[model samples]
Target: MPVPAPPAALDDSPSARRREQRGWYFYDWANSAFYTTIISVFLGPYLIPVAKTASCAQDFPGMASDRCVADFDKLVAANPGLGYVDVLGADIRPVAYFGLITTVAVLLQIVFLPIVGALADHTGRKKELLGGFAYVGALAAMALFFVEGDRYLLGGVLFIVANLAYGSSVVVYDSFLPQISSPQERDDVSSRGWAIGYLGGGLLLALNLVLYLQHESLGLTESMAVRICMMSAGLWWATFTIIPLLRLRNRPVPAHETTALRSVGGSFRQLGRTLADLRRFPLTLLFLVAYLVYNDGVQTVIGNSAAFASEALKLEQEVQIIAILMVQFVAFFGALALGRLARNFGTKRTVLASLVVWTAIVVAALFVAEGQALQFFLMAFVIAIVLGGTQALSRSLFSQVIPKGREAEYFSLLQISDKGSAFIGSLTVTIALQLTNSYRIAIVSMVIFFVIGFVLLALTNLPKAIRAAGNEVPDRI
Candidate 1:
């Protein structure tokens, strides 16, 4: 099969652009419910705690037996080498203890996403792969409604499974950028998608919150609220995703005659091929490493920030939930505004500026120990401002630079760099919390990722790769 040129003026009509843009943004909205309502706000903090009921008074903070505290004392005393911080804290939940699991999943993502991305490129199955994951994941997330009591195992299982789908679906969706966007318009489209996504995600999250609050009022256990939130996220994802699944059409590529299984096999091969071809695209590969590291940090914060605060800061669940809700709406316009800022200042500068804000946020958080609700709320707002913009610009910027004739394949690698490394971030924070008993240290740790990523991104030579990747630069990737 011959390599094809980038897509040319394909679906460039204003009406067509409007449809695609909305379709892309809607996916964000659909997925946002899970991230916002479940991961960020409710599940990790509220659900995890609710899920950690003890059989005896020995479990909860104050009631832990004198013996248990003595045991902790003896363990530390015996191993004078063992620091107080190293001892498993009273506040951290035991059931949610397998913090390492998320890291394992992330590592798996790094290994597989690019291969699938390459396969999507060769087989033109981006839409199928993405939709397949979305529906399957939606179902898995919906099943979480049944999770109750010590069903932490069930919840963890479903999170890993559904998150796998979420991770893969994003690769397919993001790969479409180089197909539908002109270089000039990619930032706008990415930003608009992100902004609308926040709105979409926020709307669903708000609705789900209402359902969750009323779960008991409607005669259900508090745990059932989790079930309702989970189901709504899935249902929201499934319904909203149909727009893109129906409207998105892949760019032309060589006709690869192969069965779906065979195509998957070919996907693995293409991954190797992309890596072997890496010598020809230095800037892209360099940028990938930077993104992989920093994005790992970003993903970690998004996934576990609330959990860390709730556990370490001893924050109220209601306060955490409200803060999360605030970020969703703030992110909506922040994405839009940041994209425009990028247009004026360039993607690199805008991204760098965002990193600076993230760094300061870490510093601020480190100083805020008690009665810092306003400070914490402000931090959440800052996250809203930078989160969407950073991700949106990063995607579109990379779209502007990837090699030609392998958009899906290259973009898949990009996804690995972004979402695949999320586990690394989560684990880092969790482990830091485990080590230092300080959410501040964990928050401070993330700054290094952003700083290093910014430095490397500054050093990346994008325009040259834009040329090396060739005439297709303005067309499809």
Candidate 2:
């Protein structure tokens, strides 16, 4: 992409910009409930019992079926259950399956994100695009209410569709950042959005946690409570989205096509041009590569944490839920604090510090023994502090390095590549678990990604990249 002319910067009055930023914050607030309740806290654990029931367990004594399933009742007649049972000749663990399901979902993002991005840039209807994808994903998440006993496949399919929609919606949502705020204000605005997301997600998760813990007393079965939690996330996501949909304005491109097919074709041509132009922005490309590697580690830790706690640490589901709730509230402050830190430190340096913390997190997770709830909770606390900081800062930093006219296109690449990178991390963990039967060893692979990302980010020439992309480099604290 030849460096596009720097567009006139956003010159909104202070109050108007603040209003737009608040609206942007709500989209994060809306979608994160689904991410927290479904992806992070509940779904992985819920799927295990369902998959176990669906497995060939009832036929265990009658005959050796093709896919072996340990009869939970017979194996643990005295205890609650064996942690896992065999399926398809492999000892099926929820963590392993969760990883596979997440991997598939991220892979789907790689296919659709570019097209979504192109359409957003060409059509100038990003708000509508965001809502379209978000609501579809919400519907998919709502359908998870029907994923009952012996329906693991249905759960997996719903998760994939929901996750794909979630990721695609984020691509459009992130592009709005540059439009709402100038480069100088992006870190603060971006961090605020993430903080709001944590609050929203945490608030809803807290309510669902109470519902889940007191299910019997409330005249609801545990399974039914979990189903209701999943359905609630979809409702929460769809409802809050109305704020941003009503407030955000589309950034118009000059002479953009009107027809859908022409718009798509134009998007493809622009995408090709953008790829060729990448070579001119070496620092941006380097940062993308670094983000691709490190974000994978970040995502794997997040995606697998609840499952790891339940399966490896043997924590109760309530304990896992509470721990995640703590993470959400803590991360809310963490993102705000990091935004201030980025003001004092440079964005690159602040993000690199978070990566160091991330590396230590995985290293520490390896030493945490099974059934060590306190140790695991402490580790989760440390993860919470860095999790939002790293992700929020990375998004702000990447926004500064993309060309003026193509925020959506570049952010689409970021969103897709972020998920695309997860494929390897998730696959590595899954394969390691299947082969070695040790999550501790499986998690160590993430350290390599963080270390490499830190080194590359440290070496990146941010000032030059910002200038090359026709963006002003924001001042460091």
What's the TM-score of every candidate structure? Answer: 0.87, 0.91
Per-candidate Cα lDDT values, in order, are: 0.71, 0.83
Top TM-score: which candidate number? 2
Q: What would you estimate as the lDDT of candidate 2?
A: 0.83
* Candidate 1 lDDT, 427-470, residue by residue in tens: 77667866665666777788888888878988887777677667
Once model 2 is optimally superposed onto the true structure by TM-score, how far is the C-alpha of residue 356 displaced, in angstroms? 1.1
> Which ten-residue region of model 2 has the weakest summed lDDT?
65-74
Residue 103 error, candidate 1, Å: 1.3
